[model samples]
Target: MPINSYDYYPLSWYPDSTRIKRPKYEAIITLLEEDIVSGVLKANTKLPSQRELADYLDINFTTVTRAYKLGVEKGLLYTNIGSGTFVSSNAFKSITISTDNSPAASIDLGLVSSFEQCNALLVPAIQKVAGQQTITQFLNYQAPTGTAFQKEIAIRWLSTLGVQTIPERLSIVSGVQNGLAIVLSALFSYGDRIVVDFYTYSNFIELAKLFHLTLIPISADLEGMSAIELEKICQLQEVKGIFLMPSCNNPTGSILSASRKKELISIIKAYQLIVIEDDIHAFLTAPFLADYSPPIYQSLPEQTVYLYGMTKFICSGLRVAYLVFPERFKNTLNRSMFNINVKTSSLDSEIITEVLHSGLAQQLLETKKALSQEANALFNTIFDCQEVTGHHPWPYFRCLPIPKHYSREYIETYFNQLGVNVYHSDRFVVKSDYEKAFIRVALSSSSSLEVLETGLLKIKEGLVGLE
Candidate 1:
């Protein structure tokens, strides 16, 4: 066969020439697996010619040929004698399931670095405290409620959001989800009514369903859930409470406007309803917007519970989230915590406190802001998405409508093929007639500009292809 005519050249053809160290055969196989899993190596895509792959990887031609055979044996690739090697249709599905059983690889994109990077500084400071005689207190079982110092940090963090609260009034939970679960358990009996925006966090919907709570979808304008509609629903239904993401709402990324917040607060207060505010994405916004408080906090009666997760901004592994309750609900929340898990993790609390004290918290925040800015710029360029009115990149969840005929899933699949991960709008919709054929790109995770640009270009190519 003529070398020029051969089409089964392996992906090794695109190797970086300056990389003098040859990748192990296993590493090469893993690379191919990732390409397949991410959708880069699409189903039925043909491998390059063995000679071409060898030249690309700067390895012996036999090595390329052997690697191709190995991939086939592993069921990642298939070959016909004359037709050439093609990616197996089920390659990624198998890999996805196997990944669950295997030890995690080093480059898991789902992993976020803000908290991990913060803990690198925190661990030493904590060790210094551990060296003290009183450190033994940390190992022993103690109060179901957090210590005064932990509460202080929680208060300080909340203060940044313009919420004022005392230690006695707060209950430190295992994490935001735990806190959410407890609130759901406490507030709603099975089949109670709850209202949320049409495109709110899916977790809220899942939780409501799990708890047997009836969820009502509230209509939303560009400013977020409409106050008039929310009031009308509350008057009509026996709503126990409402779950909301008033700031940088998940999936849709709509920031509830100040006026909308005020209207919601007044309506909820007049109806004497419970409000569960999920402010997980609050800190990701620009610093200038830090002081913006949810109207629910200011306008609602004392029964409202405001929840904030340090995990999203810090690290998911930390698993620490604090909730500020109305003064009357402190006893009730504390009892719920004791009944559920007895207490939050003191070790996690200490580590988080160290991060806050070491100034790394602020540094990470700054780093995140910068990263978000760069990612947003890259996203805008790649999609050529005219910023929809009221879209802000750093703190807001930005949605780009998928071009006609292109489903959000197709865009997701296309990006996955290019080694990029992203979410579609359907991930956030609860109950509504709204069409969700849009991409919801999150900029919270730290990524290199080069990687961002490469991913964006691939997305742009996919979008252009749709046109």
Candidate 2:
């Protein structure tokens, strides 16, 4: 096999030749599976030889061989000694293909462009860091906790979160998702009750489901999660822990107030509940805000699990989010992670640290603020309809309430047809709700004001039609 042959063959070539818009091997498998299931290729029907198929399809022999293997795996075909592959007897039973042609869509709400810009600015710094003779330190297995410099940089970054902690309390993980997984794995078992805000980060819901943790949704207001409700739930159930996004809470764009934070802390202390503070969107808050603290548990450090993702503010591609354990839980969390992933990539840590120290993070944040303001302005202008209200001009996203009669699915479909994407209220819901009331329009850092305005106009047109 030529080294560059497969690499050189454009993905478009195979699909074009086959008159199949799907991936080459996937299409071949689909065709074979269909034939077998329909009895056009009977149970005992011998498949064309790889070379024959290759010639017939005007493609490479290797492609046909791969397709056959895939078909065999799907029980559509089987091979016997000295005989060619034949359709399996149970081929029809295994021929289930999902025909879900759901539209491919995404909401342009995240401010990850700032992260990308920071990453671009840090490339040289990263190269310089790697060029150091100490680069060998990263090549070998890194410490379970992370390197000293990495820890130092992480601590400095954590300070920005208003948590003044030593490296001992922090363990660097692959990313926020990994950190959440590790924390969940260490703290809770199946059927354990974990409390979360009604409108919380969607991924946390997924993580809770994966771990089989019972997610008890706490009610919330503009100041953030209801401390009283949380207290009630903690008392009623043996709530193992609480997962919260205290600062610039996602989807809702609500910031938990300082007084509310204190109250929540007191309640957690009373209930002795472990708190997982996902401050991923912490840095986006105006630094001067008196109530804003990057890590919510800076005061009650012990019972709090502080998760800070550098990716959200600094660089998303870095895949770095530290879990600052309350001093007592550090050893246990470290051990749990080691037993699973062994250690996170030292290279990523080094790169992230280099970027942080280079002042690129600050520059990126400034740019983000400016871009967010512009995007928000565009959002306001585009959705100026009387029905479209409740949009707080936050630099990141605006929440608009839908009419009682309108379904989120219908709105999403309408926007998608116009090449605009909007997140349905259900994306933020911890528990299912029949009424699709709110739609979140994120002012993405990547999108220009003109582009955003165009998208928003389409949304307005869609809503107008609905009205």
The sequence of per-residue lDDT tens digits that candidate 1 reaches over residues 1-467 is 23343245335235333443444454566577666666677777888777776666656777777667656534467787898877765354321111243223222222223424334545565686667676766665784567788788778877777677887778878888889988888767755677887776756666664665666777788878888998888776677788888777766667788777878877887888889988877776535464465436655638679888877777767788888888787767777777887778887777777767677778768766666666677667766755554434554235656754554457656666656565555545442224556665544443456654665566566656666
Q: After superposition, how far is residue 28 of candidate 2 from its true place, in Å?
A: 43
User: Cα lDDT for residue 74, model 2?
Assistant: 34
lDDT (Cα atoms) of all candidates against the true structure: 0.65, 0.68
Q: Which candidate is the best by TM-score?
A: 2
Instruction: Estimate, for each residue in 194-283, the C-alpha lDDT of model 2 and write its tens digit.
Output: 787777676676666566566676777666788888877776667778888776666677777777788888888888889898887777
The TM-score between candidate 1 and the true structure equals 0.70
Query: TM-scores of all models?
Result: 0.70, 0.72
Looking at model 2, report the run of 10 residues with the lowest lDDT sum. 93-102
